[model samples]
Target: MTTITTRTVEYPADNLTMIGYLALPAGAERRPAVLIGPEGTGLSDVERRRAEALAELGYVALAFDLHGGRYLEEPEEMLARCMPLLADPDRMRGIGHAALDVLRAEPRADPDRTAAIGYGTGGAVALELGRDGVDLHAIATVNALTTGRPGEAARIRCPVWAGVGSEDPIMPPAQRVAFTEEMQAAGVDWRLVVYGGALHAFHHPSVDHTVRPGVGYHPRHAQRAWRDVVALLAECLPVTD
Candidate 1:
């Protein structure tokens, strides 16, 4: 197994002191970087582990925080914060840019070669970054099918891939169709994969805390989504030895 290092990074975003998890691969050579966005519940061990996994794969990865340093286990709290934030595009872009700046500042991250992958609310932030005209090699989102302002998707300069649970009421078929239509109208390369028989947040593991109805995990689909994400990165931002 390749040795990797991990650390906590504090940065400012969305009027909060964001605490992000940064993972670096074994070598000192600058490498392709990726931003991992957490779900609406905020950053947690799940996202940190993902950053570490990406680092092990030879990419510098930073799991950016959404809620300062706290994780909201309560559905009410998560929605209270995320709902309003999701409605505002500029705010999401602010958070994304702050995290991207921190990632690029790291010595091991290659600023010119980067990608963004996000889940839930974090996924919306990733899409916001693309709509804001940030240069990215690739963008992938799980369960976040947010459509941007009219004609804003024209700013996206990279391929976008999104995965969602077929039965996710939060991101149902209509929302998916709207999102894809916007992407197509803007002439951006995009694709969407719907995991059959899954629900919202299907990529996430089941938790002990109370969750909204129609939210559950599908282990098989989660693994498949991860593989698809890795493939997207390999195709768009290959890490060189």
Candidate 2:
């Protein structure tokens, strides 16, 4: 059976207990570490599976709780609970730093080889962490709503790979364009994968919301984006088996 450990961690900034699940790769000795932030729905089974999948790729994965293990089926409720964290960027900044600290503290994780990947609100949060000068080696985002606007992108220090569906309504193309221009001006090594035939949260099969036709999860595109993410992390972290 695949080996994994489930536990809870405290975010010292807020002292809120966040339930975390850590999965290890085989024959681990300070493996490359990845911090996976949950979507707006909080820490779901799919999120855990995603973390485990990351571990299978020869990296240590930590699945973080976005909403403290609570699941909200209604969009309105999720918005109500998530707005506070988003409104105060400082909170995300602190949480992201804490997550990185947790990864670095892991005996089986390589501090030098660290990357963070997130979906939805978490994606924006991860990007914000990079913007705040957190020294994260790499970043992967899936359909993030915010992108630090035009001026803030210059502050990002790490390589960022943003994966967004062409049909993502929440994050408009204009915003993506502005974000791209900002990255160029800042000289940040960043790339974007605009999936031609997918909707928001394409990698997350558990989510049922779709805006329109021809805008759903294209498995082929999702798999390719994931491969690109892994390859990018390997290039940045250079973890050796």
Candidate 3:
């Protein structure tokens, strides 16, 4: 296993003091970086572990915060907060850019070689950053096939990849069509992968807290999605020794 270091980082975003997790590979040589966005429930151990995994792969990774430092386990509370945030593109960009700044500021991160990967609400933020014309080398999202304003997608300059569960009610077929149409119209290099026999948040593990119907875990699909995401990164943002 590659040696890596992890730490907590604090930054300002969405009118709150966001607490994020930073993971860096061993050595002082600068390396490609990735911005990790967590689901609407906020930053948790899941995202932190992902960052560490990326670090082990030799990329600096930062798991950004969503709701300050709170993790909303209640579905009602999560929806109430995420619904409004999702409706506002500018707000989402603010959060994404703030986290990007933190990632790029890291001494070991090569700011010019960066990508953003997010889940759920975080995925929406990642899409917003692309739509806002952030210079991302690659963008990948799971369970957040959100369509942006009118022609904003044309501003995206990098390849985009999205993963979704076949039975995700929140991101139904029509929504997926709309998202793909937007990407196609913008002439962006994009692809979508639908995991068979899965539902919303299939990539996430089953939680102890109550979750909405149609939301459950699929261990196999989750691993498959992670492999796909890693493949996307390898293609768009390869790490060098």
RMSD values for the candidates in order, in angstroms, are 1.0, 2.8, 1.1
User: Which 10-residue window of candidate 3 scores lowest in summed lDDT?
Assistant: 203-212
Q: Please give, for residues 1-241, the per-residue lDDT of candidate 2 as tens digits.
A: 6565555555543456666777778774778888888777677777688778877777888877666556666777887978787777778877777777887888888887778888877787788887887767888888774656446666777898888888777667997887777778888898888988677767766354433433356677778877887888888866686
Model 1: which residue pairs collide? none
lDDT (C-alpha) at residue 128 in model 2 = 82
Please, what are the lDDT tens digits per residue for candidate 3 over residues 20-42? Answer: 99999998899999999998898
lDDT of 1 by residue, 1-241 (tens): 5599999999999999999999999989999999999999999888899999999999999999999999999998988999999999999999999999999999999999999999999999999999999999999999999999999999999999999999999999999999999999999999999999999989888873356799998999999999999999999999999
Off by over 4 Å in 1: none
Error at 28, model 2, angstroms: 4.4
Candidate 3 off by > 4 Å: none
Q: Against the unseen true structure, what C-alpha lDDT does each candidate score?
A: 0.96, 0.75, 0.95
Which model is ahead, 2 or 3, in terms of TM-score? 3
Candidate order, lDDT descending:
1, 3, 2
Supply candidate 1's per-residue lDDT for 3: 96
Better of 1 and 2 by TM-score: 1
- What local lDDT score does residue 58 receive in model 2, on the 0 to 100 scale? 77
lDDT score of model 2? 0.75
Each candidate structure's TM-score, on Cα atoms with residue i matched to residue i, is 0.98, 0.87, 0.98
Provide the global lDDT of candidate 3 against the true structure: 0.95
Residue 206 displacement (Å), model 3: 0.3
